[model samples]
Target chain A: MDLQLIDQFAKNIIFEAGRRIRTAFTYDLVVETKSNANDLVTNIDRETELFLIEKIKSFDSTHKIIGEEGMGEKVDSLEGVVWIIDPIDGTMNFVKQHRHFMISIGIFVDGIGKLGYIFDVMREDLFYAIEGVGAWYNDSPLRKLQPVKIEEAVIGINASWVAPNRHIHHEKVIELVRKVRGTRSYGSAAMEIAFVVSGKLDAYVSMRLSPWDIGGGTIIAKEVGAIATNLRGEGFDFFHQDTFIIANPSIHQELLEKYIVQYD
Target chain B: MDLQLIDQFAKNIIFEAGRRIRTAFTYDLVVETKSNANDLVTNIDRETELFLIEKIKSFDSTHKIIGEEGMGEKVDSLEGVVWIIDPIDGTMNFVKQHRHFMISIGIFVDGIGKLGYIFDVMREDLFYAIEGVGAWYNDSPLRKLQPVKIEEAVIGINASWVAPNRHIHHEKVIELVRKVRGTRSYGSAAMEIAFVVSGKLDAYVSMRLSPWDIGGGTIIAKEVGAIATNLRGEGFDFFHQDTFIIANPSIHQELLEKYIVQYD
Candidate 1:
């Protein structure tokens, strides 16, 4: 497959989707409860996702999709050409703050991500990657991610892990938090993962992430020589919901093997 | 005092400072160590603050200045007219991510915040307020913040509060964390407080905050009829450092009275 063509298609579709989202955001969004009361989805999320799916379908009818809002085609596996998307990654942010969210799109073939794009609609920033060509922010090619020690690293993880939670060992996570030079949580997994890929964040770990959550960012991260894997240091199943720890290749294995708790 | 003139002058200086900071962000910034190694400051922060201080001095020579990074004159009390400034309120974010930071400046006279401005430089967003003219985003005047229940509200807090901390009773903060609809931590005190003022965040809490950290936001929050105070729901020293908790009028009392652990 032509990676450049894929990147071009992905970037165009994502930015077009972002424009739709930006327009929707101008008015009072029609926000509704989803999954749980706390989890929210505005009409913009569904609308943007549907728009992207339609646009992508027009380009390639055989392509499959896995979307955050269940608006895209349901795929059983990552086989063949699959497009994973989170039209509006940070729904709550979009609904409330009208900023800090993005439109994420990733194209993969045979379980390998070939193209990734994350467009910060409000900021007009587009971070994209074509496998082996390195990542690009706006139009500038991103540099190779340098390895940094955990203590000197600026990490990104949600506060849920630090609090008492059933997903992971909180105490151990606390140790890692204190050990890191600093920690930040932006409330958007895709954007946070993009930060890791761009070398802004040394590492990012989170539990309960869907395939659509990190797909685009994961591809970009890999292109920059970073690692995106499950907490167990095993390959992630891009078809189902799972936990992930994406970081620089130098620290990925050590972080998973030494710190990430597997069985509670 | 002419509140409109103050508002215009404050907004102009902040926007100009924001332009400089935004331009500096285009290239790789020289990140430097500040009070501690983990605490960061870049040339952008100092330069931005200096730019504001110089402009403010030219605007109103009678005003005493209290600025972060020590660029302004020493301010002891909020007597006469005072300008409290944090040129780049989210220094860490600016240094690392090159975004999510802002230029926060508040005008106080007779210990009362009269005008406030918080400019998200990268996005070209200007959130400003006059004493009674109400807050605004760019050109649109902000609506009065609506009341939100704690269980349905999105809270902005430092992620550290979820872990063991001294200033706030960690256990209570954790309980509140779970009770809230969602929690977000942007790592920028000024931005976080501005979100509260804008009603994007229902509430915001900080274990330790300096005057410059909350000054501009407090002014804006007050203009929107939001409440700003120390965690204990008591008088806050605008010149001295203390814990902070700002929220919509609906939840401010409840949060501080019940969840906040005041350190005597």
Candidate 2:
């Protein structure tokens, strides 16, 4: 498989998808609640997913596709050349803020990660990585994350983590909030993960993230020498929602051992 | 007082201050902790304050200035033409993320807000308001805020408010987080306030914000037909720090009554 050729092909499709999304913004968006109030889906999200899936199929009809909107092939397991796509990762933000949302795509071959892409549609920043090659932020190369002191490290975290919640020990999370240099909640997992890879955020913690939500970010994160794992310090399971902690190599373990507590 | 002239003058100085801040990014930053680890000050922050003060003083030496770095005259009261300046709001972001930080200036005469400005230095998006005139986002005019449902309203808030903290009832804050459409913590009060006025955020809440921290944002908020007051719905005290809630006119009262609980 010509990975370089595939990279170019996918990037073009991603940019085209982004164009359609921006075009949708010109008119009134048809938005509806999905699952719950926090989860929303706009007409753009569904349209973008279908566009990506169609583009992928035209390139290679044999490739399997799993999408956030479930617009394409029903993907149960990672088999063959599979593409996991989230046309609009931050749908709530898209429906409300009109910014901070992204288009994320992860490609795998026979259950192994191969290529990934994340695009900040509004900011027009594109980040991508190929296995054993490198990660690039637009035209510049992304440097490996430098170890930062936990005391001075800035964290991109969900505010709900510090509040009383069923996921983690809110108290432990609160302690981490005070001990860190500062806390930011951008309301987008893909964007926050992009920030971590770019060194804008030293770490990012999300109690629950879907495969489509983090699949692409985790791939870019790996090339930048950052770690994206579960609370158990294990690798990501690509088919289900689970806890996620992606951070600079130096602080990943400490964040897990000290702060992230699960009810065993 | 020719408020339009002052607005143009202040906006120009703000752009110059922003240029100096970008110049400092090319060199090493001299960072120091202020009241606590979370509170930080940098050489650029201090220098920018001095630069703005010097420019304002040259324009009118009688203009009393109160800056975050205390580089200007001691301002005991909001008398004469007082400039409340936070040369670099969100200094931690300036030092760490190198983004999201802003320069905020609020001008007052006889304790009445006359003109206000907030500049997102990196993004170069300048927001300013002239009393009884209007607010502008760059070259475009800002529209008055429309009422949004609390269930669908996105809020700009500090994460600490939801954590166990000294200021307000943390539990009540957690409830507010769940009730809103979304919660965003940008790490800068002024930027959050600008977001509120621009309608990117439906509301902004901060406990223990100083006069300089909120001075500029409150003025712009007022111009956009939003309300900025304490949790108790009282006016901001320009001389001291206290709880603050800036929101669209439709939901301000409900937010104070329904969620923000203060312990007696």
Candidate 3:
């Protein structure tokens, strides 16, 4: 397969999908409840995902899909080329904040992320990356990431992790929070992962994440010399729900071993 | 006093300051530490603040100033007109993330926030409010805020508050965290407050904040029918450090009474 051809194809479809979202921005969206009343899904998410899935299938009929809103082909394994898409990451931010959200899509072949694209619809910024080729922020190639220590790093973590929760120990998370320079949570896991690749944030950690959330970002992170792994410092399964910790190469091992330990 | 003339003057100066920041974006910035090595201060912050101060002084030398970087005149009282400026409210965000930060300036007369201006430098979006003329985003006048319930509302808060801490009761904060529809922490107090006025975020809470950190946002919040008060639901003193909870009219009182009671 010509890698450049795949990259160009992925970029075009992603931008087309973004245009669909942009057009639907002016419409009155019907927001329905997903997990709960608070967890929201607007009509835009469904329509955008459908647009992407249709376009991807036309481009390569054999490819599989894993989509956030469940509008794509289901696969039990990442045996073939799979497109993981979150039509609109940071849905809460899109609904409430009306900004700071993006559309993320990842092209992976046999469980390996090949291309990642995150489009900030409102701002018209497209952050794209091809494996082995560098990441780009609106056409400017991203610089190779410099390794930084945890104490000097700015991390992205939801307040839920530090708050009393079932997934992880709050006290250990607090210790990590205090040790970091500062913390930020943008309400979008995809954007946070993109930030890690761009070197804007040194790391991003979360207790709960789906394959559609980090699949694209994992490819982008690796291109910029970052690491995407589980809390246990193991390879993440691209077809299942799991805990994610994506960080700069310098601190990736240190974080997994020292900061995040499995607690029953 | 010509409020219209002052508004125009403030707006022009702010836009100019923003332009100066944009010009420096492509250059290699000389970054230095302020309070500690971890606390970053970019040359852009100092340059922008200096530009605003000089412009404001050229416009009116008699106004006292209280600036975050200590470059402006020391403000003892709110007698006469006092300008509280945080050239870049989220300096860390500016230094690290390069987005999600704002240039905030609040004009107070006799200790009352008379006018507020928050310019999102990167996005070229401006949010401003006069004492009674109502608030605006860019040239369009913002609508009066709609009522939001806690369970239906999205909140902006510092992730630190959710973690175990000494200043505020973390457990109670966790209850608030879980009770809200969703929570986000963007790392900029002024911008967070601007979101409150824009009806994007239903509320914002911070434990340790200085006057300049939130001065501009309070005025904008007030003009949009939101309430800005201390955690105890009392009048806020704009010159001293305090715990702020700005929110929609419906939930402001309930949040304060239920979760944020201050006791000796």
Candidate 4:
């Protein structure tokens, strides 16, 4: 498979999808509740997913697709060449803030992330990486992440993790927050993951995330010498929801061992 | 005093300051700890503050200046014309991320915020408000804020506040986080305030903030009909540090009475 050709094709469709999302702002969005009140799905999300899936199918009919909106083909395992797509990661950000949301797509060959693309819809910035190749932030090559001490690191974590919650031990998370130099939460896991690549955030932690949400970013993270794994320090299964933590190589082990002692 | 003239003058200097900051990214920054380990001040902060003070002094030296870098006047009273400045708000962000920081200035007369300016240095977006004249996001008039329910609101808050910190009760803050639709922390109080004005954030809360950190944002908040007050529901005393909360009318009382029953 020609990776550069696929990357170009992905960029074209992703940018096209972004343009549509930009225009979608003028029309009122149709929104619905998903698993819970905060987990929302919008008309744009489904439309964008359908838009991507069609473009991908047209480009290559053989590739399997796993999309968050459930409009794409499904398989129990990551067998065969597959596409994992999140039409809009941080749908809540899209519905509530109208910005900070992203379109995430990861193309894998036999369970290995080969190509990744994360487009920040509003900012007009695109981030992508190829297997065995470096990452790019738009046109420029991404800087390799430097190891940062946990005490000096500026991590991104959802406040809920540190608050009393069922997902994780709040005290240990609290201990983590205190140890870090600073903490930020942009409410978009893709953006936070991209931030790890961009050096804006030293690490990111989330209790649970799906394959679509974690796919594209992990590939980009890998290119920049960062690590993306579950709280248990396991590689993503790419077929199930799991706890997520992506950090610079230096701080990843220390964080899991010290801060994430217990979680759902 | 001619308010529009002052507004124009503020804009020119702010834009000029922003330009300098954009250039500063090319050079290595000198950083220092302030108050505590995470509390930081940088050479850019001091330089920017000094630069603004010089311009203000040249324009009108009689105006008092309360600057976070301590490069301006040392006056305890909010009497006469005064310019409150946090030359580089979110210094840690600037030093670490090289983005997400802002330059904030609030011009007041007899403690009444007459004009406010917040320049997001990297994004090059300027937000300002003239008392009774309204607010502008650069050139566009900012939309008047509408009320949002606490349960449906997205608030910007530091994670440390919801952790076991000395400033406020972490449990109450955790409850607040659970009740809200979303919580984001940008690690910059001034930018968070601008987010409130942008409607990207419905409300913003900080456990403790100095005058310079909260000044410009409160003015912009007031013009948009959002209230900026202490956690105790008291008006800010511009001369001292205090707990801060800026919320649109719809959910301010609900946040205070229900969630924040006890705080520092």
> Who wins the DockQ comparison?
4
Query: Model 2: per-residue lDDT, tens digit, B159-256?
Result: 77788777678888888888887889888999999889999899988878899998898888879999999888899988888889999898899888
lDDT to native, each model: 0.82, 0.88, 0.84, 0.88
Candidate 4 structure quality by residue, lDDT tens digits, A11-49: 999999999999999999999998898999999999999
Score residue B5 of candidate 4 by CA lDDT.
Answer: 84
The lowest-lDDT stretch of 10 consecutive residues in candidate 3 chain B is B255-264
Per-candidate TM-scores read 0.95, 0.95, 0.96, 0.96
Better of 2 and 4 by TM-score: 4
Better of 1 and 2 by lDDT: 2
lDDT of 3 at B165: 65
On lDDT, who's better, 3 or 4? Answer: 4
Ranked by DockQ from best down, the candidates are: 4, 3, 2, 1
Candidate 2 chain A, poorest ten consecutive residues by summed lDDT: A90-99
Candidate 3 at residue A30, lDDT? Answer: 88
Q: Per-candidate DockQ versus the true complex?
A: 0.62, 0.67, 0.74, 0.79
Write the number of the candidate with greater lDDT, choosing between 2 and 3.
Answer: 2
Cα lDDT for residue A241, candidate 3: 82
Clashing residue pairs, candidate 2? none
